[model samples]
Target: MLLLNGDEVRKAFPVTEAYRVVAEVMRRYSAGDVVQPVRTVLGPGCDGSLFAAMPCHVTGESDSGYGLKAVLHAPGNTNRDLPTHVGVVVVFDPETGQPLAMMEGAAVTALRTAAASAVATDALALPDAGDLALIGAGTQARSHLLALREIRRLRRVRLWNRGNARAKEFLQWARTHTDIDIERMNSPAEALCGADLVCTTVDTTEPLVSAKDLAEGAHVNAVGSSVPGKRELSADAVASCSAFVDSREGAQRESSELAAPIEQGLLPADRPLPEIGEVLLGRHPGRSGTSERTLYKSLGMAAQDVASGFAIVQSAQRLGIGTMTDFTG
Candidate 1:
């Protein structure tokens, strides 16, 4: 088995390359070429964080492979000055059923999650989008910024967080690290108003972006809520937008952004819903016009984990980066 640490994985899979790989994976998914089951969640309590397990198998295009990803979401870890997400991925050869690699899961998750958003944005967002809005200042928010930068020519970014200190810190970091103009907003409305692209990365039950604040040509990526009761987009926001999802089965049960509106009758049950894979496959149309509002809700997938794991493994081998060991018994 090849063992890959976080640093090694980072060196092997750059964000740009990860985005490309994820895009192709989504295209395959859209065309019904991959097998990805909805994630299974194991939670302890209402306040207790949950653990998720996702598994997938991909064969035909490359060496047949299967992978399992485990994620722990302990929000309270923030108080301990630790990351809220931690995980790992284990890959096995399809021909032998032998474990092939063990990889750092946190980095893989961040890259694939952001790359998934980029894929959706590439397919759904308007080509001329310039202004961007980000809700939350966590790792996912940072990843979103990096991923979108690769897909669009953003000129300005507006950031809003529940805490002013966090928002200011992120704004300062953006100014120091990126050339784009960064503004710290006092409210979600201020951050969203007139923005062409909006990314919601918070894990809150309340709606962050109001429907009235969203521009007509806006494209929103709601990445915060992957659980049943956690929602960040308002019913009005969801109802008024033409929405797409990474997976319909995942979104219907796991997406709080879609569930809120769905429960309120704002989102129609009969409306034609298309997966991101279908969009990538050209079976479903993306954004119709610049005036149309589009929303992409992602509930992170196992296929993404498997795809990214495979990429990291291939890149590591090419770069001669990891230690190979035997895990067959």
Candidate 2:
């Protein structure tokens, strides 16, 4: 079995390569070439944390694998200077169910999630879209910045975070990494207003981005709230936009971004939430009008992590990156 730590996994899976792998798997997922169960969660137990298990099987002609990602989400870990999510993704053989590899899950989660957004942005956003607004300066914000820069030529970046110190820390980090201009915004509205592209990665139960504040033809990646009853976009914002999702069933099951508005009649009950894979596959027209508002509500999927982990394992094998051990010996 191959054992990969976070650093090894990150080294094996480059951000640019992740975009292609994630998009291919998503297309396979939407085309019924993959089997993935909706992630199951247990407890805000005594530690006020939740444990989630996501399992997936990909049966594509070229990429056949079975994988499971188990993670613990502890929101309070931020105070401890630790990652809020910690887990492992185990890749198994499709034919024999033998363990193939075990890798750090958080890195896979972050990279693939950002890659999914990049896929959505590439397929749905206007070709010339450049300016960006990032509402949340967490690890995702940094990852998205790296991922999106690959797909688009960003002219400027507007950043906002709930905490001033973290926002400042992000700015300092950004200055050292990329030469692009990044400005700190006083509020989410200030950050999002008139931006060609927007990403909301903050964990908020209430709405942060509204339709009124967004520019014409703006593309928003609503990435933060994955669980039911937690959303970052206003109901009106969701209603006003042509929504796309990574998975229709996952979105319907876990996202109030889609459910709340439809329930409130702000959005039509019969409206179609096209999968981003459909857009990538050319089965669905992504953005119809130049001025049409677009939203990609990303509910992170097990297939993405499975495919990413598989690809990373392949890369590591080729590069001799991770430690390989035989447990059955």
Candidate 3:
């Protein structure tokens, strides 16, 4: 077995490159070329923690193959000065089911998750889009800042968070790392106004974004709220947009971004919520008009982890990075 740590994973698969990788996976996914089961989430431990596993495989592609990601979400880790997302991704040979490599999952998850949003934004957002609104100041917000830059020439970034201290720290970090002008906002509405690309990365059950506040021709990447009962967008906000998902099945089962609205009779079940992959594969048109608001529901698919794992392993092999263990012995 091979081991690639967080540093290795980031070096091998940066967020900028991960966008291209995720886009390819999405394309294959829409064409019925991959096999991925619904992610199973268990827990609300005594401490309100979560454990989940995602498994996926490609059918014929020799490049992007098979893998599984085991993830743990510990909300209390913040107090312990550790990353909230703790996990590992295991790659396997599609033909033989042989263990190939294991890499740190946190870096992979952050990078690929944002990269997928960049892909969706690139496909769905207006070509001249520049402003970006990120509705969280956590890890995903930082990743999205880096990933979105590759897809759009961001002129300004609007950041909003419930904690001003966290927002201040996040802004300072972004200012030091990137040249984009970041404005720390006190309210979600203030952060959302006039932003062409919005990414809701907060963990919340209540809606933060409303349909009335959406900018004309804006595209939103609702990347947070992985649980079925949590929603970041208002039901009206979701119903008004041309909605897309990473996986329709995954969204229907794991995320309430779509399910909640449908269950409430807000969005028509027959309204054709095509997966983002369908647009990438040219099977469906994305963004019907310039003024249409588009929303991408990213539940973070297992296939994303599998594709990224394969990519990093391949890159690591060429770069002569990672530690190898003789599992055969």
Candidate 4:
């Protein structure tokens, strides 16, 4: 078995390559080529934090392996100066059901999440999108900026965070690493206005972006609300836009951003909710009108982890990274 720590996994999965892998994953998903069971969670009390287990397998793809990931979310840890999220992924032999390797899940999660957003943007956003707005200055926010830059020729970036210090820090980092002009915004509305692509990565239960603030032909990717009762987009925001999700069932049950609007009749029940994969497969048209508003709500998925992990494992093997050991007893 091969054991890959977070650092090793990070080295193996480059942000640019992740975009390609995730785009292919979306195509497969739209074509119904993968099995992704809904992620199951437990906790908040006796178990210490919210815990989730996700399992997936790729159809007709040998050596890709069946993948299982266990994730724990401990928000209190942030206050204690520790990571709020932690987890691991186990890849198993397809024919024997034997464990083949163990890998860090946090890195996998971040890359897969950002890559999924890139796929959505590539499909839904205009080809000439140049200005980008990012809400929040955390790890996911950084990853989103990097992943999107690979797909678009971003010219300007507007950043907003509840903390001015964090926003300033991220601005400095962006200026040092990217040639794009970076500006700090005092409000979400100010940051969102006139932006071609808007990405929300903050953990906010209330609406942050509204319909009135968005411009025509804008594409919004809401990535923060992955569970019940947490919302970031207002009903007006959802109503004024054509929406798509990584998964329809996931958006219905887990995405408060989309669900809230659906419950209020802001969005039509008959409105076509196509999967990102379907868009990638060219089965459904994306961004039908150049002036239409489009939104992609991501709830995260295990199939993404499996597909991304497969990419990392292959890269690791080629580069001779990771610790290899025989787990056969």
Candidate 5:
């Protein structure tokens, strides 16, 4: 089996290539060409960490395979200066069911999640949307900045993070990766006001963004809250926009961003929350007009990780990256 570390995974699947791979995966998933069950999340131990098992299989694709990503989400890791998400993704041959490769899951999640957002933003945001408002300064924030820049010409970035030290660290990190001017904001409202594109990547249960602050033509990628009970956007904020999701089933089961709005009757219970895939497939008109607000609720899926991992394994094979070993010595 091939073993890939975080750096190797990142090198094998850059954000640009990740965008294309994830987009195709989403399309196949929405078209019922992929088989993925809803992920099982077990959690909130004494330390408030959670573990999840996400698995999927893709059919009718050149890189069809079975993949399982077992991950631990430990928010407290920030205090320890470690990543909050850490785990491994294992890939199995579709035809023979033999384990083929194992790779770092955090890298895969970071790459594919941001790439999925970029896909949604491209399909739902206005053609020229550029100004960005980022709600958190974590790893996901950094990845989103890089991925979004590939699709849109960013004019500036407004950032808000709970910790000033972390925000400063992120600013320094940004200087090396991007030339775009980023302003530090004291509050979420300050960062979000009139921004054309907004991303919320913080780990929070309470709302940080409000509908009152969003511009008419704004597009939001709500990335932080994936589970049912946690949320980052106000109910009104979600209700005010035309919402899209990575998967309708996943969103209905796991998205806190949509749950409150749906329960409060702000977003009609029967409202159609189209998948980003549907938008990509041209089955749904993502943004009705320039004046309409659009929101993409992302609940990361197993199919994405599987398809992405399959692609990464293929690329590493051709490029001679990663360590290859066999257990049957």
Candidate 6:
């Protein structure tokens, strides 16, 4: 068994490499090459935090295997100097059922989530899109900024967080990571103003981005609030866009961004609007017009972590990065 920590996971899987694997994973999932169930989330209840078990199998690939990711979402972890997401992914040989590897999942989740959003944005956002608006000030927000840089040549960045001090702290953090000019905004609307690309990473139970505040032809990555109870985008914002999702089955039931409007019959409840995988596979044309709004509701999947974790372990092995423990017969 190979044990990898968060830093090792991030070191082995760069955003660009993560992007490549995620693009392949989504294509495989939507094409029926992978088998996974909707994750089972058990909440702390008192704090609305939850833990989940996501297991999946991937076939017809060099990394074919059964993968399991046990994840904990601790909303209060930031206050305790811990990651909001903490987990481990274990991969086993499909034929022999022998364990292959184990790696940290928080870094895997952050990079893969950001990469998935970048894939959608690259497919749907207008070719000329430049400016960026990042909502929320946590790990996802920071990772999205790094991942999106691979897709868009960002001209300006506007950031807004409910915690003004935290947003300012993120701004200072950004200064050390990249040379990009980022302005901390006072409000979500102010951050959204004239932004061509938007990534919402806030933890909210209600709508935050309004349709009226969105710029013409803007592309949105509705990333936070993965479960049924939490939401980030307004129903009007959902209605205004050509919506896309990571998984049709998962999004239809689990995406807070899409669930309400879909349940109210304002948006399609019978099926998801269309998947980013479909767009990636060229089964559908994304963004019908330059002036059209586009939204991608991202619900994190087990297959994503598994596929990404598998790739990360492979990368680490090639680089001799992790502790090689012997689980010998």
- My TM-score estimates for the predictions, one after another, are 0.94, 0.97, 0.96, 0.94, 0.97, 0.95
Candidate 1 residue 17 Cα shift, in angstroms, is: 1.3
Deviation in Å, model 5, residue 232 alpha carbon:
0.5
Runs with alpha carbons beyond 4 Å of true place in candidate 3:
94-96
Question: Cα lDDT of all candidates, in order?
Answer: 0.85, 0.90, 0.88, 0.85, 0.91, 0.86
- Candidate 5 overall Cα lDDT vs. reference? 0.91
| Tens-place lDDT digits, model 6, residues 215-284 | 9999999998888888888887888888999888898768767767776677775643788888888888
Superposed on all Cα atoms, the candidates' RMSDs to the truth, in angstroms, are 1.7, 1.3, 1.5, 1.8, 1.2, 1.6
Against the correct fold, how does model 5 do in TM-score?
A: 0.97
The digit string of per-residue lDDT tens for model 5 on 130-222 reads 999999998899999999999999988999999988899999999887887789999999999889999999878999988999999999999
Pull out the clashing pairs in model 3. Answer: none
How well does candidate 1 score on lDDT at residue 192? Answer: 93
Q: Candidate 3 deviates by what RMSD? A: 1.5
Candidate 3 per-residue lDDT, tens place, 84-191, comes to 889999998666777899999998999999999999999999999989899999989999999999888998889999997889889899889888889888799999
- The alpha-carbon deviation from the true structure for residue 66 of candidate 1, after best TM-score superposition, in angstroms, is 0.7
Clashing pairs in 5: none
lDDT of 4 by residue, 41-86 (tens): 8875764578999998866453355898899888888779777789
lDDT of 3 at 29: 86
* lDDT-best of 1 and 6: 6
Query: On TM-score, who's better, 3 or 5?
Result: 5
lDDT of 2 at 79: 91
Query: What TM-score number comes out for model 4?
Result: 0.94
Q: How much is the lDDT of residue 160 in candidate 2?
A: 92
How far off is residue 39 in model 1, in Å? 1.5
Cα displacement (Å) at residue 190, model 1: 0.5
